[model samples]
Target chain A: MSVLPLVALVGNPNAGKSALFNALTGARQKLGNYPGVTVERKAGRLALADGRPVELVDLPGTYSLNAASPDEQVTRDVVMGRQAGERRPDALVIVVDASNLDNHLRFALELIALGLPTIVALNMVDLATRDGLELDAAVLARELGVPVIATVAVRKRGLDHLREELGGLLDSAAPEAKTLPPERDFDAVRGEARRIARAAVVRETPSRRLTAAVDRVALHPVFGLLLLLGLLFVMFQAVYAWSEAPIAMIEGLAEAAATAARDALPDGMLRSFLVDGVINGVGSVVVFLPQILILFFFILMLEATGYMVRAAFLMDGIMAKVGLSGRAFIPLLSSFACAIPGIMATRTIADPKDRLTTILIAPLMTCSARLPVYAVIIGAFIPARDVLPGVGLQGFVLFCLYVAGIIGAMLVALILRMTVTKGASGGFLMEMPKYQWPRPQDILLGLWQRAVIFLKRAGTIIFTSTVILWVLLSYPKPPEGSAVSQVDYSIAGRIAGGLNVILEPIGFNRDISLALIPAMAAREVAVSALATVYSIDAGDDEALLERSLGDRLKDQWPLPTALAFLAWFIFAPQCISTIAVTRRETNGWKWPMFMLGYLFVLAYVAAGLTFWTATALGLS
Target chain B: MRLTELPLRQPAFVDLIDWSVLSPSEGQRLREFGLCEGASVEALHHGGLWGKGPIACKVGRMTIAMRRNHAAAVTVRTGPDAAP
Candidate 1:
């Protein structure tokens, strides 16, 4: 009986290694955490030459063998068997982008010296040909002494050939490749790459047309900036316009379900919990799914089309003004989608100080999940109408909120850069791929996956929290002889009233104060919590809360106070996930605590300023 | 002539140098296109209005923006036009 061999897949970003992993493993793959770390480890079983099962490990993408970030450290550790409980891969598969072999081969050459039995898969051959690149696979195979298979992972072409080559490697008695000599490492390998390219590579025909078109538009200073802004405007409009109907339908369904559940059940705590607590709490929060999906859809499309890489180019000047390099923009952009991945993306920034600075500021970017809370509040209080002909007042307000987040993030980043980690700029290097239309299937799959995740959270965390909130606010039967409401007697209301003392300066009443506790599950949960609390008070409420709030707020809190509350949530650092991820990324609680403390101070100051000014203006 | 003085549409092959040495917001782009010191490339096309768009040049297998400063760095001898 023969033991199955272990194989590792490695490459630079956009080299199609992940696509190849999907093609090879199909349904046999499983994703899991690597020991204690949050970095994902994927393993799959594949049939080798002798009909034996082999395990394939797909490693994270990296530029070179020289490790910088934690993710890159993982790649080096796994390959060299330095990781605890993780074995070294028996063989290596170096995926190369055929269109831009120069840069890809630079990394490949370094990997070739790692002394593993290796094979090369030249991916995106069609792209290479379309762009007039010519790579002689036969010559490359001879030079590298490894089987070079041309593959188009997206089209599923060359799988059979890849499989056959893998079989040959599994069976052959070819000696393992020689490792780099003790004195020589990356610098040596880079030197060898230059020598090899100079000897063998030559441009048969220069690529001119497509690049000319792109350069003319993108390299022009003023025009490029305008195009970038236009693209951003369109993205924001799509987030609102595309997701509107779905949001309305979701809201309608939730309300109708609450009414049905309320009418069917007896007038008791169980019915209230179901109607006002769980259904109202979770449903209102989940309604933001369409908006979040629309936001991510545009982001992923920008990423896939390679324009995002260009935006880094476009943002360098702006970032420099804030004491960050253009490289920081990638992580910042990632934060706008989700801060977890954004923190992880900071690994690409190279410099430890720069990475830390970017991590500290990442959460300040407004994520899509925050949109529902903003939308509900803004729609209720901000007043939607045509500010001018064809200009949406609500849309303008939304834009301002986004701008506020950006400005806040920049301010924090500037402070961090000037005070904590003043240093020299790191070397910035990135590969910009040829521009192409984004793949539709990839976009659909991405959107569907996110939607499913959001719905799952709704079914679990949001649902449980809502039901519990309902129960706490509904119990003790309101002491039938008493004049006060049941909720005023319940645990939730008592807790809120107790907490109101601390929040008094911020002008939060008991109901607003009560909402903050459950909002820890997510920032958006505050809106749903408020909806649940108010729905309980109103008892299967007639008019929407916005209208009621408009009147109630005018009478009680005043406009400045209302604006202050909005500003508090905007900068409060209320997200638990952001805190958790920050801890995990920094490998400590220090940064997360610092983040929370500063954001709270900022929120308090902003709210205080707003409240005082409004009172002074006699708006209350 | 110095590379920067090369007339419009003149084909040139040159080594890419430091991008920051050229201009701000400019280096980010050259880096994006995989053009850095010691990377060999040729500017094969040019001419476009600023803000309207970038002037294009062939680099590797892709067409890329060839800013005036960047064009100045690359020295080339006339060859058969590689323009499509």
Candidate 2:
């Protein structure tokens, strides 16, 4: 058997490192956490030209080897053989964005200085050509004392040649390819790189005149801010515009499935469980997947296009006012999709206090999981009447809810910044990369991954939770000749009813109280829980369940109480995954517990205030 | 001083080398881009549209942005001022 060689991939952000990894490894890859940290590590094996395998480790992206962040530190540790019990790869595939080679080479130069057997993988060559830039690969390789390979990783253009070259290098195992001169040889290498770079790399045109011209207008205080807001408005509108058909289709299919199950099963516990408990509970949340996917698609596009950096830059002043850096904006923006990623992104912020502040406020961003509950309640009660001449009242209310989250996060960040620090605040500094049109392939890749994750969560957490909630609300039939509904005798109802006294302050009745239990699994599960509870007798009819909710709230519960319930759902920080992630990220129960405590206080206070104000106004 | 104090369109030599070796902050940015101490680099242009324009250099790989304030720090050493 031939000896297998090892290859490592390294790059700065947006350098197509992962694309190259995918091209090399195909579908064979595994994701694992880097020892103790939550930073993901991906590794795979690629067969060489000689049929021997080459192990590939795709290192986390970092700007430089200075290693300020944990992700960067991992890269530095692994490359330097400082990671205990980890074997350093034989050769480093230094991926550089061909369009932004100059900015990227600073890191590349550092990697070259590390004296590893290194090959420069100049990625995005096609994009570079489109920009009218050219690189002399041979001359560049001569300059750096390493082979240079131009690759369009997205297209799988250079993999064959790359494999061939690497296989030959490994087969030869040339002593020169395997060793560095000395321990302190970096200064000489750096000097040599400068001399060679000056000779090899040349600019046909020495200007970013186009970028500057665009930025001048876009970064203007007055117009830039307006443009940013306009961009966001368009994104939200697209979410609504594009997702409507898909959502309706899914909803229709679910209703149909429920109907079919009802007809197929005999009128008994089996029929009730299948139709009401299982189908209704899971179906309610599953139908909202389209809107969630649409929202994530736009988010991923904006991120890839580098427009998010501009948004962060524009928001820097506002963030600074609240004692946070522009860096917090990245995580906060990510939090708009989900708090887990938003918390994970806090690693970018250097200051501990600022990182913590960002993490604490992340859940307040109103993730997509809450959208189902919001949509259901708003659709049912919130008047469709427009306040403006042409604007939608429903959309306006949704906008206000989003605004409330932003304001709440800022308020908390401000309070924490003042209290935690003795008037010393963390400063935000960041690189503002030139904006480019988002690559369609990259955007699609990101969107596909996000959609898969949402589907996976829906399949596992929502599916299983719905079934469990269904069983809890279905089994142990009420006694013979019982006047009350079967659900009234179910375990879920009894538990929720028992808790209603304490929840009475927020105007939660037995049904609402019971819904909150499954909601801990996911905020959206509350809708399914409600559906399950209502459909216990209605069987598989979704339309009937929807009407039942409307009727139950309108007849049994006052408008003020419903409004209070809405307020509670909006402000209550539920979701076990979120709290558990917080615990993991913060590395303790302290912050998660603190988060739950304060959010509950806020939820109750908000609900109570809404109830009182609505009652005072005599709305119901 | 800061790069903001340097006069625009001036040809100045950076005195310091190995800028990437500095703190991963803005200070390191100046050094890494060959704007180090005693190295000759010129800011060829300023803002055309954006409030801050991309400064093209006669020196390194990356073009660093020069806000109006920092563009004044680089002292020119051309013609009579050129050190032999």
Candidate 3:
């Protein structure tokens, strides 16, 4: 019953549907590829040529109305007017890749058969011409009995003509189902589509097919994998190397702001709230923005070039051996950067069980959030001197922590596939899209959106949690001038006192317990929480005050506690944002709760084991 | 012979398929990839770090990546090009 004349842009996967939608309607919602990179429906407002505003939706790409995956199901449902929460679209713009006409035409034909007001958008006509093929839009329009608009969505060609056609169609009366073609099987429609495509093409010539030439090496057994590996190495290296200056810059600004607030405000809870809770808590997260953006830039760019799919193809064998799908590879790799997007990326996974398994194991990857915890602990305990000639002991242990997460994830995936999420790995089946240089605008747009989301989380989830944590640490102040620490009188401190009883068996002290609770807000928060606790404990002791957080920890914390805590972080679902995203993606409390439950158990056992082993070995 | 057994770059017709053995989604994918009976297919590439892995096949104008297991269920006749 919604009024804005709804127009749904539909097409086969990689048919330039999304690009066209972006061109016609300024982007609104996001998708992952079901959204694999996205599945969510993206809707926007498009003003027709006559200044008539209409609602436009970009549905998930589908091969045909016969939906194969949940993503395709949305397309099918929306188009057929069966999708809940959406009105039947008033008109359909069936987008087809001009170069791959035969395959794309099949889906277009199926949609056209639905008998709604429809037009064919011969998208990517420029690519087709480049590939040495000429498309006759008139012939196509005549044959299909609908307007055929040749569009280069990326370049915004034929968009005005497209909008004109849409305006005219929507201005006219609602078309009845009089044009509904007779029910046909898959082959019948596809064969007819081939005939129509053959008729529409005016010329064809043999050109060097770039995709095939690239695949010769990209899909090669040895070189393709090596290339993929090289690309991944470069991506990780860039994330670490390129992000340092931006992080430091963000940190410096936060410090300056905090200093200004401290100087301007009278010293009290207000100053502490502004300095510690608002500025420092939020600033800690904003600092990681550079890393997140850097990681997403590489993922988005690779995805745009269509190499991401090929990466999955190359990794299928190894991934299959572990009882998971190849599609799981990208998400798992994404987890190393941050588990939030990684879990969101699992929407691309088709199988219910396969997606569930990927979600469950995604957090087990050593996200950058855990890097601070590891860096702090390792700097305090592990020696920087080389264990081997060139391999520093600290770096080696860091490497081992990453390796441990991977091995743990693999074992857990194997076990889950056999138990809770038991199912045959949904065999990886995907269309290898044609390679094209990603437009700079698209890459920038994607990165901008990602940065916005990351910042938004800092504002909402991190903001609320930081305030609550600050409140917990502040209230119930110490009795007047007793030599007692303020934290010892606080509610959070008492909670940690109780938690220490449970964490004690694994070598954790009261301060470690205090830090672990806030660390659940984010893994990196553990470092600051530890620093805060130590500084509070320092309390007028000038020697303790001058020492760095790491140095203080080095003196008081045993090697076993440090080792056990590192082991705990490797498995713990420490980041609230990851759990929140898990809840959103899975659409219920069931999965996120399951994720938290299992991860807590794993963290406990891992810490206990590491504690017992290190203690017994007399490392203490 | 099964589609996996076809020699690389050799155009073949999908002669028969055991739909029962393949999952619903797998069959749907094959259909979407245009690997139906009598469709001309050429095994373009073998993916993964090993020989036994997913197969990249040219089905019509599109290239589809599928696992060896799914490819094994598809029977094909490799000879002169034939329309299904």
Candidate 4:
């Protein structure tokens, strides 16, 4: 057995580094957190033509080795072999955007000074050529003192040459410490890069007219904001419209699977667990796959097409007014999918205060986890009328719920900025990369990764929680002839009964209170927990048990209570994983505890207000 | 005049970068993006209704957006060769 050599993929942001990594090591990637930090650690395995394997780590994209931001610090640490628990990489694969060599080559020059065995993958060569620039690879190689291979990462061009070069270097001893130009100052390195570029790169004609033409409209103050909002509206609308058929298919499959299990197995604990715990619990979360995938698809597309930066540029004015950098927009937008990644993405925010404020408000963005709770509540309570000619009233309400989260986040950020995190606003210096057509493969890969992550949670955390809830609801035989449901005597029932004292004022019944306990672990689990609890409470009423969870909730709870539940979820301190990630990212229990406290108070007050207002209006 | 005072669409040569107005890291970043002395920059757009938001400037072949406060630190002079 031999240790696989570690090869790190390093490049500037949006330089097609990840794309090249994916091209070289498809489906062999593992994503985790680096040692103690929440910064994402993505590593993959690449095999050479001769079947020898090497580990490839996709380091966080950074502009330079100045170590200004956490992400950049991690990149610097890994390249220098200073990151704890990680050995120095055997080789370095510097992925550079050929179209943007003038700007990218400076970083390339800085990396070369590390005196490591390095190969430059001149990625996006096709785009560079399309832009009418002629790049002499051999000349660049000679000028940089390293092998340069032109690559179109998206199209898989020049990857074989890249693999061959990497393979040949795998067996070579570490390069001896070569005396290189002093790198203490960036000016010297940047000057050297300019010299190298002038000697190697030839320009035929200037390109980027198409990009500039598109930007003219996309960056128009009036039209640009409208276009951005329209794009977001369409994305949310598509999440609802496109996910309908797939959600229905999944629901149908879950029902059929439950039915099959019920008919095949004898009436026993095993059968009950199979249908109620496994099928109903995991099934509820799994149905959300389509919506999550749709959200990520749009996000990944916006990112790949280079429009996200322009969006930040457009929103900077409004965002800055709320005391957040425009760069905060990307992380906050990512929170719409999940807060963990959104919080992690805040590393790009160079200012610590701005990054902290972004993290504090990220959970208010209404992640996809909350979609299940909102979907069930809205489906049952909100009537399916056409608000517009084609839009369902349900989706419109769902959109409003999402908007409420965004507005809440902004308010919180404003409050924090004016008080605790108050300071000079962070600088919003960010590069607006040239626009390109998003590659389908990259989109597919991104969506695939999201789906896998969601399903893995369903299979593990949701699965275990559901089984535990089932046991809690099923155990402890009722006293003989006791005039109550079996669940009334169970442990979970007793706990909910006690909790109802605090919950009743907010229009939550004992059943809703029971669901709230597990909902803390993950918001979507509340729906499954309610379903399992209600099904058991309906014992001996086969038809009632078979009724859809939404129908049952509508029958059991008043409209005011349902509305209150929706309001509760809007501010709920749910999703323990989010809190844990926050703790890790902030490197303290203080912020997470504070987050939990404020969110709880907000949820209680909002739910109470909603319930009382609806009751006062005679809706109850 | 400060880079922030530069008219939109007019190119100027950066004269001096005053590090006093910006934090150390921000000054380093601005320099890394080619906003150092002698670099040619063209103000492309000013954000917000009152033009108090981030200013988008073209540096080399890249366009970067920075707050007006940070842009105020860099003094520039309009030049014929620097015109876009």
Chain A (alone) TM-scores for all candidate structures: 0.89, 0.90, 0.87, 0.97
Per-structure clash totals for the candidates = 12, 23, 15, 0
lDDT of 3 by residue, A1-620 (tens): 55888999999889988778878876555543332223566788899898988888888887877675567777887788777777789999999999998888888888887889998999989888888999899999998889999998888899999999999998889777533345788888888888999999899996988988999999999999899867865665565567779877987898788668867998777877776677766776677788778778988888888898898889888878778888898898888878976887787778888889999999999887777677668768987687777546766677678779988998998898899888667878888889988767777877888788768867876677677767777778888987767787788889999999999999999888987887787777776666556544554465764565578888998999999999999998647778777877788889899989989999999999999999999996
> Candidate 3 has what TM-score?
0.88
Quote the true-contact fraction of every model.
0.06, 0.02, 0.86, 0.63
> TM-score per candidate, in order?
0.84, 0.86, 0.88, 0.96
Q: Is the docking of candidate 1 incorrect, acceptable, medium or high quality?
A: incorrect
Error of 2 at A503 (Å): 2.3
Docking class of 4: medium
Q: What Cα-based lDDT does every candidate model obtain?
A: 0.70, 0.71, 0.81, 0.86
Ranking by TM-score: 4, 3, 2, 1
Residue-level error in angstroms, candidate 4, position B19 = 2.2
| Fnat value of model 1 | 0.06
TM-score of the B chain in model 3?
A: 0.88
Best by lDDT: 4
* Candidate 4, residue A607: lDDT: 94
Model 2 CA deviation exceeding 4 Å by range: A1-6, A22-32, A43-55, A81-87, A99-103, A113-115, A126-133, A154-160, A174-192, A385-390, A421-423, A537-557, B1-35, B38-84
Q: Which one wins by TM-score: 2 or 4?
A: 4
